[model samples]
Structure formats: C-alpha cells, structure tokens
Target: MEQTLQTSKMVTEKASPLSRRVTWYIFGVMFSINLLNYLDRYIFSSIANTVAKELHFGLDGIGFIASAFLIVYTVFTLPLGFLADNLSKKRMIAFCTILWSISTVFSALANNFLSLFCTRMLLGIGEAGYYPAGTALLSQHFPSSQWGKVLSWWNVGTTVGLMTGFILGGMIVSTFPHGWRLAFLFSSIPGLLLGFLVWKFPTKDTETQKVSLNRQLLKQASIETIKRIHQLLHIRSFVMLTAMQVFAFFFLGVTVTFMPTYLQQKDAFHLDAGTAGLYAGLMVVVAGVAGTVLGGILADSWQKRFAGAHILICGAGFLLGALFFAIAMLSSSFLLFSIFLFLTLFCVNLYNGPAAAATQQIVSPAMRSSALALSLVLAHFFGDAFAPSIIGIVTKYIDPTHGQHFILNSAGQDLRLSLLAFCPIALFIAGSLGIWGTRFAAVDQENVALPAN
Candidate 1:
C-alpha cells in the first residue's frame, strides 16, 4: 500500500497539467502576499528618521530594531522550512499571514524599541515559513518546462512588495503629519485579507508518499528526506550555489537596509519618508521586474545549449550588479545615482530566477523542498542575519563623534561610504561563487536525478 501511494504521487506529479494550473493560480495569489511581506519589512528603513525621532533611539538601537526581525527570520526559517516539507503549504501560509499581520499592526502601537523588537520577532515567526513553503508549493504544482517562467512570475512579488511598501509608506508619511505608524498599520490589511483569500482557495495535498493512516504516521521515519538533503549538500554545485546565495543576500540586506538613509544624506534630499520610498519603489518596479522575467526566459532557453548556462548567467549578473552599485554609490549626481541603482537592481534580479530554478532542478522532486531550505539557511545565516547590525556597527565606528545626531543628515555620508565598499565586496564574492557553481552542475545532476516529466 505504501509503495502504491508513492507511485501514485509520482504519477500525479508527472501527468497532471490541469491540476497544475490551479497551483499556478494559487502561486499568483501567494505571490501578491509575498509582496506585502517585504513591504512591511522594508518600509521601516525608508522612514527610519521619523521612527527614531519618535521612539528616541540612536543608530545602534535602530539597527537592533531592524536586525531583530532578520534574526528571528533566520533562526526560525530552518525549522519552519522543515515543517513546510512535512506540512500543508496552504495552512502554513495562512497561519503565518495572520501572525505577521497582527505583529505589523502591533509595531505601529509600540512605545519603545523593546516593544517594537518583540513585534518584529513575532512577525519573523510568521514570515519564516513563507519562502520554503511557497517554493515547494510552486515547484510541486508547476511542470518542469514552465518552472522557470512560473518562478519568475512568483519572484515579481519581491519587487512589487518592496515598491508598494516604500511608495505607500512614503506617501502616507508625507501627506499626514503623524503618518509613519499609519503606513505600517495600512500595510497589514492587505495581508490579512489575502490570508482569507488563500483559505477560501482549494488546497492541494503535499506530493508525499502515503503512510498508513491506521498506524503512527506522524512518527514514521523518512530515510529519503535525510538521504536527499545529505546528497544535495555534498554536491559541489549545491555548495557553490549556497555560497552564491550568501553573497547575493548579504549585498541585498545591506543595500536595502541603508539605501534610504544614504539617499537623504548623500543627495541632500529633504523629501519626506514617503517621497523617498516612492522613488526607490519606482526603481524596483521598473528594473527589478524586467530583470527577473528576462533572466528566467534566458535561463530556460540557454540551458538547452549549455549545461551550466544558468550559473554563468548568474555570474555575469552579479559582476554587473556589483559594478553598477559601486557607480551608484560614488556618483556625485543624484539622477545618475538613481540610474545606477536602477541598473544594479536589474542586474541582481537577473540571476534570481535562474538560480532558484537551477537549484531545484539539481534535486529530486521529493527532496527539492529540503534542498531549497538548506540553500536558504546558508544564505540567510551568512548573509542577512548580521547585515543590518553590522552596518550599524560600521557606522558607529566610522563616525563615533557624530553623537546623538546619528539620525541627522550628516552622519549618513560615512555610513554610505562604508556600505559602498562592503556591498561591492559581497557582490564580487557572489559573482565568483556563481562561476564556481557552474563547474559542478554536471556532477550534481548525476546524483539528484532530474525529473523525467
């Protein structure tokens, strides 16, 4: 009976396009939710000045508040990722939505840094399960032929979410005298509503081998799960891919965390938080979306000719992203700076779709969730977990005499310079890792057994 169930699952995975479309629809809905995830996380930085003033916190305190979420997000992602493999993806997303949504609203109500930190941590617990579950659900639902395109569409949510949060938050703060809190509060509504939409949608069962309902199924062992994760890690491709993820995320974390402040300080822009967010969001929408779609299309097409095409593309993107970011940071003209930032975002997203698809392709269907989770763990651990805090520390050390006015416009110049150097360094490492990843794709493919469907 157990063997029959496993075979049935395999057949279903192979033969069902009709059912797969339903998964895509859900992917679209969930993708929108993902956008909100980032919006809530990112808008804080855009309005850092106002938040710090209102809360009476220094740069270190602000960094701690921001880092709190990433720390929780990083710590919980591994366990939640494991749960995603074993549990219902739909339920996981729904419950997490509620958790983060509530925390987001509570963030608006916080009286002190500690209160805000606690709320962010709770939000992290909710968000922690999202990526692994979302990735696994999409992979299971989509066919191999369409995985790159489908994942690319899903990836659009990140840009959209960041843009929406920035623009919307910025608008609210500028229009209203005391609007930053309202902006955070407003961002939570869409997610809470989306949670309802997800619950109403029919959920597909996880494509796992069947276990005896009459026996202790919950306690059953999963040799395949352990073996697959072990094999994926040992694969040189996976290792290098993970290194690439780490580098990409590190750059992403630092840039996102600091960009708004840099703009205000370096450009001498006096725009309210919402206006700054609007500009940044527009850049992401224009550049980030284009890069993601193009990358997916290129990877899908290029892979037919070159076995390591995806990694090579990623390598090129990272190198370009690094170069563009350095130009953006150093440019004296703000318009030219914006152009560079736009190009940098474009370059970064160019590699995202291909990298994700390549990672899954090199793992078996049954183990793809765990494999991706492991990749995420390594990425977040070495990348974002310490990023915001590190930037804050760097700022303090670079210009310690800036004193309590760390939130002032002048202090950000040194911060931007430090980040300019650090971000490029991380991107360069990621670019090199991408090249290293390409070399081992053939060997990795041998162990994971690509999908026949």
Candidate 2:
C-alpha cells in the first residue's frame, strides 16, 4: 500500500487543483521559498563593505560584483519561466533552491573577488527560477479577486527575508571572526531544507516526471513563445507597468546596495556595521511589511470602485515615497532622517502587492509565469542589473574624503552624489508611468476574460 501510494503520487492528473488543506500547505512552502530567496540574495549587501575591504575592491568593483548576480538572474529567468508553465513548478523550485543553497556554501569558500562573483552569479540562477514559478503557482490557486491580498502575503515573505538577511549578516559578522562566511553557510541550511520540503510537498499522487512533462511542452515553443510575448506586449497597461518596474528597481537597487554603507559614513549617521545593518533591516522590513499588506487591502477595496486602482495606488505611493526619501537624503538630523527613511520605505513598498497582482490579472492564466518572467528579465536587466555598477562608477570619479577608520578617499561623497542624482528622478518616472497605466487597466484586464481564439 505504501509503495502504491508513492507511485500514484508521482503522476500528474487533470482533476481539481488541490484540497483546501493542501492549498495552504503549498502556499506555506512557496512563501518560505520566496522569503529565503531574498534573504540569500541580499545578505551580500550587509557584508559588502567588509568583503570589499578584504578584496581590495573599490566602489566600482563592489557595484560590478553586485551586478554579476543580476546578469545571470536576467539570463535564466525566461528559460525557467517557460519551463514553469510546462513542467512541474514544485520540482523546478526544488531544484533551484538546492542549487542556489549549494552555491551559497561555495560563496563562503571564495577567497577572491572573481570567485565570489562567480558564486553570486550561481545564486542569481536559483532566485530567478523560483520567483516566476512561485508567483504562477499562487495565481492558479487564488481567484483574481483575491490576487492582491494573496500576492501581498507573498511579498511579505520577500520583505522579511531581506530583513533577516541584513540583521543576521550584521549580528553574525559582529559575533564571530570570518562571520561573513559563516553567515553564508548558515543561511544556506534553511534553503536546503526548504527545497526538499517543496519537492515532496502537498501530495505524493500529483507529481509529474520532469521528462514526461517536457514532452508536453509546445511543439514549436520558440515561435509560440514569441507570439505570446507579442500578444502580451500589445496590452498598453502591461507596457506601462513594465516601464514602472524598470525605474522602480533601478533606484531601489541604488538605495538597497549602498544604504548600509551610507549609514557608516563619518559625515552621516556614523553607525558601526552591526548597528547599521540592524537599523537598515528594521526600517526597511517594518515599513515594507506594513506597506505591502495595507497596499494590497486598500487596492483591492479601491479596485471595486475604480478600474485602475492598482496603478493609482502605486502612483500615489511612489510620489509619497519620493518625497520622504528625498527628505531623508538631504537632512542632517539623524532623527528627521530616520523618520523620513521609515516613511520612504513604507511608501515604496506599497507598489509590491498591486504591481504583482496587476501582472497576473492582465494576462491569460496560461501565460502567467511566462509574462512575469519576461517582465523580470527586462526589469532587472535595464534596472538593477547595471544600477550598482553605474552608481559605483559615478562615486569612483568623485574627489576623496578624509575619515578615521575604513576611509577610502571620497567614497561616501561618491555614494551620496550617485544616490541623490538618480533616486528621486527614477521614482518620479515610475510614478508618472504608473498613473498613466490607470487609463488602460480596465480595457486590458477585460480582454483577459474574453474567450480564447
């Protein structure tokens, strides 16, 4: 009987998707995966200064190293995204989780910039594989009416992961010698364990052999994919949303990558690394969590009355976020900076739920994963992928500043100038695009409900 059950569970069936109990279970697994995904990816931010010191990398090298992961991440998103719609999402997520976890282990062993950069690239592959698949799976499980709330919960996982990554990275680094490496090793364990759980999750009877699933993919998948891509692009709302993601991620990359170090600047907060990490983590996570959850609830409520509520909320959030972020940047008072920083984080995070839900809603159920994957490919590539490096280059050219410990010419000035020049303007663009997206949302989403040709 045990053998029979094991064999039965390994086959895919075209029945009701899942029971309520199993649905929640799968949600738990995907949520956990999303959380760990961000944590592992951004822990590097917390330890970047320390690693740069040892590796003799300046701001440019630091930014370049950060971009390495994004480049590979961008490269892999579409292929895995294509597979997610055709293959077993659970298994693919499992494979990605395990692969990235092992890669992170190797990151601990890296002794040079090149070795570490290579490991980060591997990490990117895992993360890129998980996101679209996870989002697609959840989309199928929930009603469109509930998509905002559901994805908001998913976004919470991402926020928490980022928080844990920074806080843990700081605490561990402060507590132990070579703590940065240990942080990598420690974080990898949870992902390794979670990967196995996702692989075996929900039921034994619904699993499909990867090889068999491959045979079921579109016959002329390349041509089919292109057609689908073109179809999605024809939707004016999708185009506007994609444009929003580009600017949003770019400025987000600049701030997330450099803010911790910014806290350590002599002319700024002058906090130690551990303190800096804690403050950054707490501020971002708390505000991010509140914004994501509230934004979803509010958007969903507003959507009933307005066709473009998602984009409307996102536009408002970005505008408010820009204001607070700008205040944080220009203020000399630590108190005012901290307060505005919190507001900035909250406002910016408001986009998470509405934006994610919008993508899922405006496309056919069949194209959910592919649409998101393609969007991410473009978003990260043009946005965060090069943001760090570009900002680093800008910072590198600035004149030096004298400081006590860990001073590197004018590195602080470089980071400050780079952030100020780009962040507000980027948010302004994203906000404008999002607001314009509202005009087309009702029409585009209506098309998704039409009968298939």
Candidate 3:
C-alpha cells in the first residue's frame, strides 16, 4: 500500500504543469486578494467600539451588527460556490472583489446603525465569492502534495488583512477626525486594482482549466447538488473537520468583535484605542503568521511519516491553543496576558493550512468549491454568525451588574467574562473533534474518487 501510494504521488508530481514562476505569481495575486478580503471584512470589527459610540448602540447592538454581515455571508456562499464551479474562477473572483470593495466604500457613507448593517450585509455578499473560487482555482494548480504548503501560504492573507485592519483602523482613528470612514475608504482601493489583475490573469496554460458556463451546465439539477453535498457529508473525516470549524470560527468571531474594546478598558490595559489596536494587531501578525506558516510546513513534512499528520497537527494545535487561550484570558497582569496571547494566537491559527488541504484532498476536483462552500455555510452560520450576538446577550444580561463600580462598564466586564466562557471551551471542543477526525483521515483518503487529471 505504501509503495503504491508513493508511486502515485511521484506520477502526480511529474504530471503537474505549473512552472515555479507561474505558480508563485498566481499565489501572490490570490494571497494579496485574500488579504484584502479579510482587511475589509474585519475593519468593522476593528472599530466596533467607536461605531457603537457614534451610532448610539450598545455592545449587544454591535454583536447584532456583526452577526448581520455573517448571516448574509453564510447565506450566499453556496450559491456563489456553485457559480464558482461553473464559471471562470478568475472572473468570479474579480467580480466578487469589485463588489466587496464597492460595499466597503458604501460602508464609509453610513451614519446610523441601520445603514451600517445594510452595508455590512452587502459586503458579506461580495466577500462570499472569493473563498470557494480561490481555493478551488489554486487547488487545481498544485499537486496534492503541495496543497498544505500553498494553501497555508494563501491563508496567511487572513492574518495579515485582519492585523492590517486593526492596526490601520487604530492609527487612523487615533490620528484624525472621522478616521473610521477613512479606514473604509482606504481599504477599498487595493481590491479594485487586484480585481483587475484577477480578471486578466494569464490563461495560456491548459492547466488553468476555466470552467465555462454552458446551456446544459447552467441547467444542472438541484438533485445533483444535493448528491454532491451528500457524498461529502458521508466522509467521516470531512464531517469531523467541518464540525470542528464551527468552534474555531466562534472563537475568532468573539475575539475580533470585542478584543480591542476589552484591551482598551480601564480595568484591563487602560490604553487608547490606537495602542489597544496596535497590541491586538501585532499579536495577530506575529503569532498568527508563525502558527499558519509553521503549521503548514509541519503538516506537509510530517505527512511523509504519518498518513493522518494533517488532522493530527490540527488537533494538537487546537488543544494546546485552548490551554493558552484560557490562560491569556484569565491573566490579570499585562505581561502574562501578552505572553499567553501570543501563544494562543499561534496555536489557534495552526489549523488554517492543514484544514484547507484536508478538505480539498477528500473531495473531487469538480465538487471542491461546493463542498467547501457547504462547510462554510454550516461553520460560519452556526459559528461566528451568531457569536457576537450570543456574547452580547451574555454580557448585557448575565450578571450585568457584577462590575458596575470598576472602571469598566457592565458590558465591558461582561465581555471579558464572555470571552473567558466561550473562547477556551470552543477551542477545546474543536481540538477534540480534530483528534477524533484524525482516525478516519487515512481511510477517507484511500477511498476518495477523483476524475483523471
């Protein structure tokens, strides 16, 4: 079995058509675009506190607003994924980028909660198209052996964009009047240009197999779609990996929504928004980048010795990450919190690359986008989509009067308590799921059916 597997890998490598330079160029463009995706998506989260003050909404309101975007984001992903599978991926990506950038620009025009919520929901619609298309497009470019590394490299865009949103939002909001508006305005430009690049991406290579829209293809039945989804769910490893995604997304949603505010509160760091953002953003870049890159390398390298290495790495990261996350949230001292936060971000981010690679590996080339889209639908909807609101409710109602005398508001302390409650427990559950999934990975891989390359 081992010899046959080795031979198959060797053949796939030789069959790959992407030259190193072309491959890297595609990666660079996709990575940059992906960075922009998260940058615009999280800018709202980065400046949630300011928005709440200006709009006269409480933290709970902020939670609902964040959830609004995610609900829209989750709802549209599968439809967009179907389009991604049937249409030219670059074109879909290009259009999605432009759509989201325009939505970000509109975000700058909002003065009230309703307007902001509407703009964010639109942003969700625009941003939803990129992942399914980009992931599938890139997966088709590399052999299976390279998916973990390349996807990890691409996934770093999330950490970079998220960090940039916080840092940029921080620097601008502190230095100037109406900085949040400017932040949104500034973020929209790069995507417009990147969308152009995606649209014009060289199609000379046959390997860049552009799935074009045809009459019959357009009329493809819903039953076929259902069948595709059914196949993916039946794969035990895939099911577990997706089940784990929900918890991880929930942890991220809560953190992104409230961490800056948490750090800025008097009882905590007592820093200005800029300083708080700087600290949060720095942690994201430093620790997040480290986790993602190293995780990818470890998964790829370890796979040589272990068939379940990708899932194993994900499980270990999530478990270790949860421990650090709990410590970071519990620490009273700045030094201790910072140290544990770095550790938490590193371990929490470790699953990005390996998880992406694993999902792709188990599905066929044709269903890759839709399968991942299905996972996103469930993960984001149940995970981050309601996290802010759930946390918000907890903060507002659950022992709402506990810390009234402290420098923090009732909600602020509630936010801390909420994070303490949700983040670590979710991470632990996610880790446990990943460990359980590892056992099925090898069996699933051996059984996966793929069309001839």
Name the best candidate (by lDDT): 3
> Which wins on lDDT, candidate 1 or candidate 2?
2
Model 1 TM-score is: 0.90
- The CA lDDT of each predicted structure is 0.77, 0.82, 0.83
TM-score of each: 0.90, 0.92, 0.93
Predicted structure 1: lDDT: 0.77
Residue-level lDDT of model 3, residues 261-336, one tens digit each, is 7877666677777887888898999999999999999998887766678888888898998999889878888899
Across 165-223, the per-residue lDDT of candidate 2 in tens digits comes to 88988888878888999999988999888999988876432222244534335565677
For model 1, how does the per-residue alpha-carbon lDDT over 119-205 read when each residue is reduced to its tens digit?
Answer: 888888888888877777777667765777778888888888888877887788778877888888888888888888877777565
TM-score of candidate 2 versus the correct structure, residues matched by position:
0.92
Q: Say what the RMSD of model 3 is.
A: 2.7
lDDT of model 2 at residue 389?
A: 91
RMSD, each candidate, Å?
A: 5.1, 7.2, 2.7
Residue pairs clashing, model 3: none
**Deviation in Å, model 2, residue 383 alpha carbon:** 1.0
How many clashing residue pairs, candidate 1? Answer: 1
lDDT of 2 at 434: 92
